[model samples]
Target: MNLHVIDTGFFKLDGGAMFGVVPKSLWNKRHPADENNMCTWAMRCLLIEDGDKLVLIDTGMGDKQSEKFFSFYYLQDTITLEQSLAKKGFHPDDITDVVLTHLHFDHCGGAVSLNASKGNFYPTFKNATYWSNSHHWEWAMYPNAREKASFLKDNFECLESSGQLKHLDVSDWIGNGPFPWMNILFVNGHTDKQMIPIIKYKEKQIVFTADLLPSIHHIPVAWVMAYDTRPLITLEERQRFLPEAVSNEYYLFLEHDAHHEMCTLKDSEKGVVLDKTLSLDEL
Candidate 1:
């Protein structure tokens, strides 16, 4: 199996929100903010070429949103998702599966695009099945007040409307999770039933650390995101997941960090600290 890094683009978000309770005195040193107090973050996705399945992990925020809507995020893209996939010798229709970690705009927005021919939104990969868990699907369908803004209907409403969306069953998640080489980790701290994909690549296990562990800086269990609905649950999730990551020697594939692509964590005297930073090619 081969894995490809799909970088759709970068955008900005308030550093305070991204770092949660971590003070500017500390996080500021790691991520400098602009005059607007927004830190740039990458909307990095992943592509998996496993036998006949050409699977895409996440789609960066799509371009269908209104200009006013995008101005808030300061989105910038050097290459389109189509171009990124073309560089890897595949097209949108070539994709067989799309694994959505959650239904947030940045994470799953690109799943749908405005069809120029139809004057409406439609699934981007017409041939692929869009993957999202049942619980998350419902949560996004009816988002809470705190998360409603992040769960934009235009980003994903087309998937199910077009009959291409598939809700992966998590009830039997512990039963090897519907994939032979990939396992799903259900985390609820960030959002309801967020599915983190742990794929067996090369000789090591690669964990697609979505929002649960957005960047290497988030390795410190206490550095949870303020966007999390339940901050305490996030702390609990990190406390349990970090040690297991170290023991299993899993490589974390970061999705939002613009500076770092992937990183390995080691159990230091103070707890899990980044051991090494590298790109997917190093794997």
Candidate 2:
């Protein structure tokens, strides 16, 4: 099995919001803000090539949003989804499975695109089966007051509408897959039922750290995001996942870290600190 890091591009968000309860004095140093007080973040995605199946995890914030809508996030950098795929000798239509971690605009927005000629939304991966959980699917469609704006209807609706959506509930997640290396674990707190894929390749386990660990800076458990609906639950979730990662020597593949691609954890007096940072090629 081969894993590829697909970088869609970078965007900016308030550093304060990204690191909940953590003082700006600390986080600002980690990710320095621009004059607008927005810190830049990478919308990194992963491509898993196991035998005949090509699976992509999380599409970055797509380019379909209006100019006014995108101005808020300040989506910069030109590394587009199509360009990234082409670099790896694949195209959007070549993806067999698209595992959505959650339906947030940044996570699943690139799953669909606007066809200029048709004037209708369509699945970005024409031949792929887009995977998302039933609970999360419902949560996104009928979004609550807190997360309504982030869960864009155009992103989630296009998948099912195009007959490319597949719901994977709690009962459906078995570690072993049709492809021997891939497995998924569902966690809540960030959103309802976010799916994090754990890939077992040879002796190493590499987990796709979704929002649970957006960047290496988020290794400190208390450095949870303000966006989390249940911050306390997020604390509990991290306590469980981090220790297990340390014990088993798991390589964490961060989605939003622009500087570091992957990291291994080590227990410190202050809990888990990043042991080492390296690219996927190093593994």
Candidate 3:
């Protein structure tokens, strides 16, 4: 099995929103903000090459949105999904599975794209079976008022329209075996049924952190994001995930962290903290 970090460039979002309830003085030290108070974050995705299955996790924000939308997020240095995959010696057509952590715009937008001529929406990975949970699929389709804007129809529709949308129920196992190498963990604080993929690689367990732990700075229990629907539930979720991470020495693959990519957790006086910072290559 091979894992590669797919860089889809960066975008800017309000720092305050990213770090919910945490004071600027605290989070600012970790993720410094720009003059406009927006912080630049990497849309880092992961490509898992296991045998003939090339799985891409969480496509970054695609370039299909209007200029007005891009202006809000300050999308820049976008390395398209196609370009990033080609760099790994694979084309979009070569991808066999796309495991989406969630259906947020930034995470799943790149799953679909405008045609070459910008005429209509299409699946970026034409041959991959796009994987999304049944719960998340319903949540995105009938989004609540708070998250409605984030659930863009173009992003979700393209997957099904391409005849490759495979809704993974709560019990779908990869390769259909008693002991699955790839296991899915579900968390609800960030959004309903956000699936985190836990991969057994090199006799080690590496978890794709997704939004549950956006960056190393978010390892602390109280550093939960403001975007979480239920902040208290988020606290509980973190408590559950942190100890397992520390005990198992799990490598966290961050999605929105600008600098640090992968990190391990350790118990600190204050609480759980980052043990060491490294990239995926180090693993």
TM-score of each: 0.97, 0.97, 0.95
Candidate 2: minimum summed lDDT over ten consecutive residues — where?
171-180
Task: Give the per-residue lDDT of model 1 (tens digit) for 54-162.
Answer: 9899999988888998999999978778889998888999999999999999999889999777789888999999888888899999999999999999889889988
- Comparing 1 with 3 on lDDT, the higher-scoring candidate is 1
The global C-alpha lDDT for each of the candidates, from Candidate 1 onward, is 0.91, 0.90, 0.87
- Per residue, candidate 2 scores C-alpha lDDT tens digits across 1-283 of 8889999999999888999899988998888888888888899999999877999999999899899999999998579989999999999888999999999999988999998788889889999998888899999999999999999998879788778888877767784344457678788989999988898876899999899999988988899999999998899999999999999999999999978999999999988788999999999
Name the better of 1 and 3 by TM-score. 1
Error of 1 at 61 (Å): 0.4
RMSD of each: 1.2, 1.2, 1.9
TM-score of 2: 0.97
lDDT of 1 at 23: 94
Query: Model 1 reaches what TM-score against the true structure?
Result: 0.97
Per-residue lDDT of model 3, residues 1-283, tens digit only? 8998998989998999988888999889988999999999989999988878888889999888999998999998668767887888888889888899999999999998787586888888878888887889989999999999899998877687678888776667555522267888889999999988888999988899899999888888888888888878889999999999999989888988889889898998877888899989888
